[model samples]
Target chain A: MSKKSVPVVNIADRLAGFSELWSQKTVAVLNDYEVKLAKLRGEFVWHSHEDTDELFLVLSGRLTIQLRDGDVVLAPGELFVVPRGVEHCPLADEETAILLFEPAGTMNTGDAGGPLTKAAELVS
Target chain B: MSKKSVPVVNIADRLAGFSELWSQKTVAVLNDYEVKLAKLRGEFVWHSHEDTDELFLVLSGRLTIQLRDGDVVLAPGELFVVPRGVEHCPLADEETAILLFEPAGTMNTGDAGGPLTKAAELVS
Candidate 1:
């Protein structure tokens, strides 16, 4: 593909353009992985990816990844990686923007099935 | 490992604490990939990853990825990925902080092998 075929994405601009809580939009693809952005608020269900690790980077506001053992709190510009098979729940006290890096086909909700589970949609 | 075992990384904080141009420091590991931070200024040797695609997210300042066909310019909060085997060189007129995601063993210099070639080191 030509260079023009690849789109340039501004994380903040894209996040500001969308306002859906817990919905992830794939902004770019790098080989087998996808770069995603989402708005998060409240609490998500407990879940774990048995085979793939999940990466979370806070773009704005704050986020807390609650685990059975403890919580990993992330402020703006902070990031954390939840190892594979480790169950956890993510929460944000306020509306927060986040970036995620993970293998393609990796479910956002992982093994848990719930109302919040949705496949990621590609964003231009 | 416990939640405490995994270090929480603030991208801006880590980038601020270090001051080495073109050197990448691995901050976190997620599955088969490594999350890295780096400071870029001036120009880097043209190279390509034969096996793994490279992801670059600009945290501050601006960056230009010079490709054989065209250039991809990224501003703060923007990102671009150079597909595997695509020769490219990255440049930044001013000091720039960036986040990188790629397979653990991928080299920064790729097949071009030059003075800038170096292995990524793990950071706390």
Candidate 2:
């Protein structure tokens, strides 16, 4: 079915339904890109998507993206785009919900090898 | 500067800062795509982007995307992606703030041209 005919994807309800932390669930697909949601706490490993740009939209709580030079802190309704090839780490003091947008088939941890790296899963 | 080193783009704050209606302002750029914000009301023209998909995430108020077969109603924190080549129109009974994701240089009105057709503006 066409995306326009699909059911509306509710961000909060979906986030609340998921139990895993730092594991991204693909909620929607927009052409070549995918919209994923995740709950985060503590710090994610420093990684970079060499060929893809990643967007982080904070749905709730606060998230800080630490870069080599500086860190960008996003509030509940804020967002930041990590440019392609930029090494950065996402950190949060408390539980934070976020929506991510990036090309389809993008690995969450990029080239960084670690246990936190995961293949994104589609959640209905 | 890399996006990770830049400032956070707050969705609500940027939406409150704008005075125009149905005009989209780019808040962030992610590779070939852009994250945009806009305030919408009334009904928009029926049009379709032949080559690009469009995403609508409602921040506040309500929005209905009228498609060829049916309509998808979106509430706060809800989102829907209009697939490429699908004819659709967005409608809202009250003022609604939204975030749009699409490729750069995408025209607001798509193939069907009229006064509402506009070039997306960059807010920052």
At residue B33, what lDDT does model 1 achieve? 90
Checking candidate 2 for backbone clashes, the offending pairs are none
Fnat for model 1 comes to 0.75
Instruction: Assess the local accuracy of residue A119 in candidate 2 as a C-alpha lDDT between 0 and 100.
Output: 85
Rate residue A121 of model 1 by lDDT: 90
Per-residue lDDT tens digits for candidate 1, residues B5-91, read: 558887777887889898889999988899999999999999889998899989889998999988898888888888899999999
lDDT of 1: 0.88
- Here the TM-score of candidate 1's chain B is 0.94
On DockQ, the leading prediction is: 1
Number of the top-ranking candidate, with lDDT as the measure: 2
TM-score of candidate 1 to 2 decimals: 0.94
